[model samples]
Target: MDARITKAEAALLLPATTIPSRRLAEVEAIRLAAIAARDEAVADGVRRAGQAMLNAAEALVRALVTFPARIDTYRALRRLSDRELRDIGMTRFDIPRVFDPSFATRAANDSPQAPQRAA
Candidate 1:
């Protein structure tokens, strides 16, 4: 019996004995790419959320800054006489509503001066 294998026999068995290093490398590369993509998506989400928070903060600051001015305007309107208020197309009662965002629409709906919409 022969103790050593021939070159042809070794060549035939080479593929079975060797590890699939190239396939393993490809799988590893794909895994790394997936991790990189997931990290980028998370970073993008965090950036968008931070920007939204900053915008909300800026809006709050602007509202706080303008609040005293709105109060001053309201006080000035309150000081006016009924005749003076009427001259401005508003009554003393309407002064409080002047600062309301929906004032124009509400006044138009409630005013005697507004034209009647036919049924």
Candidate 2:
């Protein structure tokens, strides 16, 4: 017994109402089903590619060693302009937190150009 069975093989197991014509119809049905499955797999591959990029970015942010290296990595991620990164997911400022915890905290609290904003 062949371990692998295709849609056409499964259809062949069924009793044919019209003997000769049934084989041709079953083959066409299996071919169409195979094409649909292939297209779905292609679409899934593209989706996984995009998700891999986001996972890489997140990992890069988490693996910064020094301040300068962190800054460079943050800039690269920022260049993507992905809103998911901007909205508390990840940001350039998170880079400084590794080197200067206070600086990161203060920046989060204080507004840049505070005096200008007052005027």
Pick the lDDT winner: 1
lDDT of 2 by residue, 1-119 (tens): 97999999989997875467878888979999999999999999999999999999886877654557867766666565535444444445554453555655554324342333355
The lowest-lDDT stretch of 10 consecutive residues in candidate 1 is 106-115
Clashing pairs in 1: none
TM-score of 1: 0.54
lDDT of each: 0.81, 0.66
Candidate 1 wrong stretches, greater than 4 Å: 1-20, 81-119
Give lDDT for model 1. 0.81
